[model samples]
Target: MTKIFFLGECMVELRELDDATMGQSFAGDVYNSAVYMKRCYPKLAVAMITAIGRDRLSEKMLSRFNSEDLDTQFVFQHPSKVSGMYFIETDSAGERRFTYWRNDSAAKKVVQFLNDDVVEQLTSADMLFFSGIPLAIIEQDSRVAFWQKLEHLKLAGVKLVFDPNYRAQLWANKADAIEQFNKAFQISDIALPGIEDLNVLYGISSAAEAIDFFQQYQLEELVIKDGPKSVVTLTGTDLQSHKIIPVTNVVDTTSAGDAFNGVYLGARLSGRTVSEAVQLGAKAAGTVIQHPGAIAPLAAFKQAMSEAGL
Candidate 1:
């Protein structure tokens, strides 16, 4: 079985759609990926590593994780730190914008709880997944410790998948964010970056430029997403492009990229080729934008999977 470990925060999500209706859900980059990964590949062993509080909302998130049959044995529950929260507002065309309230989230301290056993768990996993936000949220020492541990895991042959989900508000300045984001890319075996993120972080003009820049790191597989345009990927010396599958009606695009990363990696882990994986990723993302929340209903996702032959 493919065992994957995802390290990041899962927060309480409040979404306001085009219809002006509001609803609450749970999401974070790695957490959303974990859910979609588990759902798409039930045989794969998936676990999330993060810190949460002992609050009611925290308990509810755990229950939701359990319902999806995700393994939480590696999760940490902090004594005092509270979970983070974010609010989403979507435009009529289904594009999303976020406002966060996560300055003091419990996940920032996750590295402090890491021990020898935790290191062992991560090193033995088939893959370790994280994003730039997770690294940016923590303290200097914690970030250092976390990167060292990840380096050790890489030496043990655990693949690293990184998403440079750059949020400018999370960092002290643009230069700091660029430095750390590049640092993460160097260690990443697979990179999933949005075109907008690259523009925000590196001032890149287009997806091709983003791919060319990251190609310097010699990533094993690179996928660059440009909303409603096309996805650019590089496998070895062969660069390919796939057009975005059209969404009939885009209701909200809150988790479009996260959902794509999840299904794409899930398919790849299940022995599909890079092209096949991205196809599934595109389909999953297209379906997600047609819904109102980060996680569309299980039935809706399954339907999309079936239609896409995922």
Candidate 2:
């Protein structure tokens, strides 16, 4: 079984329901991807690495992870800090707006809890996944240490996958985001970046420019997502574009990209070709947009795959 380690935060998510009520769950970029990946590939040993607080909410989050069958052995508990939270509000068109309450989240201190055992756990993984959000949350000093550990893991043959799930509000400034993202790209074997995010973050006006920028990093594979449009990809010297399977009803676009990342990686790890993986990823995201939250039910994912003949 493939041992996959995801390093990031899992926050308390409150989404506005149709009746004006709020539905609560646990999710984050990498965390959402982790959940979907586990559901897609049950035989894989999926684990999450992050810090959680010793609070009731944290306990509930742990229970949810366990119920999802995700390994939480690398998860750290902070005695005083609590988990971060965010509120999601969707518009008439199903686009999402977020309000964050993560200034002092326990996940921000994950680096402080890292030790030799944690290092071993990370380095031993077949693949390690993280996102731009994880880089944004950790302290600057801690980020140095975190990247150093990732460098060692990469040297040990653990493939690194990164998604530049860029949120403008998370970074202090554009320059800092660029710098950190560059550092991350250098270590990533596979890069999953959204064209919209790249355009906004790096001022790249077109898909070609975005693809060219990532190509400079010499990644083994690059996947660029453009909502409702064709996805651009590069594998070695080959460059290809695949169209998205459109979703007629998009309830929430909160985790569509995360869903794509999860299913795409799962498909590839299961020995599917790049074209096959992108199709599965597109199918997964198309299904997720019809749902209301970051994580659609495992049944929903399976149903989506079946409907797509994946």
Candidate 3:
């Protein structure tokens, strides 16, 4: 079995059900991808690598992981801190607005749990995936340690996938985000970057500029995504553009990019062609955007996958 580890946070989510109602759930960037990937290819060994607190909400989080079929071997528990929480407000158009209270979340100290044995386990994995959210949230010294481990894993032939899931609030300044994202791009084998996110960080407005910017990095595969537009992919010297079938009835745009990242990587790792993977990703994103949250209903996503022949 091919083992892949996803390194990030899993926060408690509170979303508005209506003016006087709310619903609670658990989700984060890499956590969403890990769950969707496992659902897409159940035989693949999928693991979640992060820390949670010993609290009621943390217990719920762990249960969610188990129910989603994500491996919990690398999920550590902290004594004092608790999991982070965020509130979401959706407009009439289903666009999401977020308010976060995650400054001292247990996952911030996740690197403290990355002792030698954990590092060794990650190195033995077939792939490791993360995003700019984790890069921005972790402390600087701990990030140094984590990057060292990522380098070691890269040297051991573990494919490193990075998604620059940028949020302006998570980072202090654009310069720091650029510096940290550069380090991530340097060590990554596959990079899934949304051009809109990069526009804020790099002043890049179009896929051409984004692709040219990535020319500096020695990436095996690079994907530049723009919502409802053609996606651009670069592998070696071959570049291809894929037009996404626009979803006219988008309910929520929260997990569109995450869905694409999950199914595309899942398909590629399962020996599908890049075109096939992109098709699956696009179909999955179309379905997810028509739903209402970051993690869509399992049956809906699987049905989309089946429709796409994923």
Q: Would you estimate the TM-scores of all the predictions?
A: 0.95, 0.96, 0.98
Off by over 4 Å in 2: 18-20
Off by over 4 Å in 3: none
By summed lDDT, the worst window of 10 consecutive residues in model 1 runs over 15-24
State the weakest 10-residue window (summed lDDT) of model 2.
115-124
Q: For residues 1-310, what per-residue lDDT tens digits would candidate 2 score against the true structure?
A: 7899989999999976668688899999888888888887788888999999999999999999999999999889999999999999888788988899998799999989887677876777899999999899899888889888898899989999999878888889989998999999999999998878888888876678987687679699999887888888899988998877688898889889998998899889989989999998888888888988898877877877878765
Tens-place lDDT per residue, model 1, 89-118, is 877787778888877788888998888788
Candidate 3 lowest-lDDT run of ten: 87-96
The local distance difference test score of model 3 is 0.90
lDDT of 3 by residue, 1-310 (tens): 9889999999999987878998999989999889889999999998999999999999999999999999999999999989999998777777889999997799999999999887887887999999998898888789889899899899989999999988888888988999999999999999999988899888999999998999999999998898888789999998999988899987888888888888889989999988888888888888888988899998888887887785
- In order, candidate lDDTs are 0.86, 0.88, 0.90
Instruction: Give candidate 3's TM-score.
Output: 0.98
- Highest lDDT scorer: 3
